[model samples]
Target: MVQPNPPVLEVSGLSMHFTSGRGKKKTTLKAVDQVSFSIGHAETFGLVGESGCGKTTCGRTIIRLYNPTAGKIMVKGRDLSGKLNKEERRFLTDNVAMIFQDPIESLNPRMTIEEIVGEGLTVKGKMNRAEVRRRVYETLDKVGLTQEHATRYPHEFSGGQRQRVGIARALINQPSLIIADEPVSALDVSIQAQVINLLNDLKRDLGLSILFIAHDLSVVKYFSDKIGVMYFGKMVELAEGEELYKNPMHPYTRSLLSAVPRPNPLTERFRVRVNYDPEAEHDYTSEQPRMAQLSPGHFVWCSPSEQQRYESMMRQ
Candidate 1:
């Protein structure tokens, strides 16, 4: 899951470990390791990486779906890292919502749009059936659907429409922070634009903070004010979107950016893809590596020597 935009929340040394097998065969996997970043109150923070980099895992961990092995998850001065009490649980449920990746899989085919979108209100028992129905229609309309569409099932809608339904469900709670996991990946190019535009409009009108996780650099750059690039459960680079694109410091980030196809035919032809093999890139034998600031709002995971080198490179 993602954040609202600015320092309303902070995650310090967050880690999630999964252990499997028995005895000698037992092994532990650190899906997220010492990952730390703060998200603002009403802005979009784009998280990008190749598959299996712990983007989704980190989000899930923050949302408390999986217990963290170690670290602190703080929101609005409340430490939410460990087990949550009833009040903390209520706070989490009220302020945060997630729109999952698969449009079809995320929604229950048996349930109508009204049922799915109004579930939050119904669960809290704060509204009657008529009120829930009215709120559901209003929420649905916010995402580009109409009151008449509320009775339709998931099977009755297109992929884009289904995604919009998912959005409405998340919005019905009037959440401050939304963790949208690859929300547009399953749709066609045209539909992706529509959904993204809807999100932008909603963000502007409602002042929402979003944690947007996706593989599309173009979309991430366009929609996010800040971007963090993750690699192998670590955030390799993070900065404002413009700074990240203007000057990517980390080798892995450079490698990732090199792969993005430029629109200009001349530049695209000349673009050199940087192949980043982590083992070959750096030697952590003599020194341990950690996240270090090369400049304000620009950070890189590096050892002391590497930080010096990066500082030198920036100067050059």
Candidate 2:
């Protein structure tokens, strides 16, 4: 039997809660509530949800942009949740990179593409100017930008070109795990395809594990090997991309999938939107729900009774 490669990213019971006000007036918002998932080497794990579902917050927390209130984050076998030592900090910087959502907002207006892309290497203080420039050119070339474009400022380039510059910056570090928070959401449809294809090629060539966060399930389904659907602050459903599309067990997941527009006119005319009401569909007053394995590689957050109902539905 062939053994599988170890997971590149592992998160368990991750939570990020924001607190406001003082004393009796304090209120806590659970931005990410006990979320857990894993990403395999060279695989894409898509986190899909509606707006304000904590998808972006989850991605930010994993990369230590925000200190997690609860849970453990193990990236490349190193614990990243707790306080970091110098080496741990170095490890995080060297092995992980992030691609932000807004292309224009992410890039600095004053900096040329060369300066922006090479900043990571320059900050390391290890590579000299010549080395950084050379690497920046090579990285730009990898992302389909020519050396000539490197001298131009962000304002000089189109939206797509600017996004490519962002991608080049992320690639400059040669990271193993990339947390892409809606990397293509801001681009035009044509531009989105180009960027996604570039990312696919890079993932194949570099064997990089990607945590892709997006609100569009159709986009996630196309790019992800595994898909996890989040609702509000919890992961409601998770399975292989195709599996989740074919068999969405949770009411919230079903509602989300039902909203995806169809290409065919006939299908579009007949598409019925599913409205999900948690309070109406679930009787959680008696028993609390938890993430349970309903089948191989499939999990749903539900109580025992709900699991039984889902299992029966799957059988049919």
Candidate 3:
């Protein structure tokens, strides 16, 4: 059998920390701690966790929005670490783009939708005025927005429509990797499905790779091929979406799945409650936690005792 190609984006030992104060009073907050994962070409990889668990930070760091304090971020075999020449930075920008959660805030209120979508092309000097307009119109049509809507301000559109504009802007660059950070979290339940379907359609139509970050496991399960569960500042579980949902490895993952509201009332009644003390502080002063492969294509981070207990439980 022929082996598969390597992933389009590979992140290894990625870590991000924030240092505050000075002298003996200096303190460090590990926003993203030793995370590693890969996204195949055209794959939808989902990262799910609570609000403050560093999901957004990880996504931002991968795109170089936040310069990672440590580790490697490889895009199509090129490591984005050292300062790149002007042209190289431009190339990276064109290859990877992000779609933020709030479309209203993400889109400049001053700019028309056409200008917003065409901004990337304008910056890259990729096309003249006529060509830019033509391309922008085409992209708008692709995202289910009319050419007329292009002239309207972001505030004029509904939440879903504005998000479509955001998607259009990201897609206009024709990026290989699009990091969608909680793209549907803000939309109404009815509109959320529409946006999710639109994203799925775009992935198929454009042959795009997406790193979808969200806190909802059900949505992530529907959109992702593989899922990585984050807790605090670490990835506690990584596995195929279906497998992870059926058999969660980490305690955190299990707790999350247990809380998913099932459609069946009977099953929903049996849902387990996960308790985490928000007021309690975590002690991270010891040796750094390391992730270990628990099975083929599945990984988890746990103490030696916890790992042994997990293994014994699985064997039972």
lDDT (C-alpha, whole model) for all candidates = 0.90, 0.91, 0.87
Supply candidate 2's per-residue lDDT for 283. Answer: 96
Q: Rank order by lDDT, top first?
A: 2, 1, 3
* Residue 296 C-alpha lDDT in model 2: 98
- Better lDDT candidate (2, 3): 2
Per-residue lDDT of model 3, residues 1-316, tens digit only: 2136667789998999989999999999999988999999899999999888999999998878788988888887777865667776787787899999998899999999999999999987858999999999999999899999988998899999999999999988889999999999999999999999999999998889999999988899999999999988889899999878777767778778777777898767876687544234222345334687766777878655556666676666
Of candidate 1, the 10-residue stretch with the lowest lDDT total is 1-10
For model 1, how big is the CA root-mean-square deviation?
2.7
lDDT of 1: 0.90
Local error of candidate 2 at 293, Å?
0.6
Compared with the true structure, model 3 gives a TM-score of 0.93
- Candidate 2, residue 295: Cα displacement in angstroms equals 1.0
Q: Which runs in model 1 stand beyond 4 Å of their true positions?
A: 1-6
Clashes of 2: 0
Clashing pairs in 1: 1-59, 2-211, 4-43, 4-209, 5-40, 5-43, 6-39, 6-40, 6-41, 7-40
* Candidate 3 segments whose C-alpha is farther than 4 A from its true place: 1-4, 276-289
For candidate 2, lDDT tens digit of each residue in 1-316? 2135557898999999999999999999899999999998999999999888999999999888899999999887767888888888789878889999998899999998899999999988998999999999999999999999989999998888888898899999999999999999999998899999999999998898999999877788999999999988999999999999899999999998888887889789888999999989999999999999989999999999999999999999
Task: List per-candidate RMSD values in Å.
Answer: 2.7, 2.1, 3.1
TM-score of 1: 0.96
The deviation in Å at residue 158 for candidate 3 is: 0.6
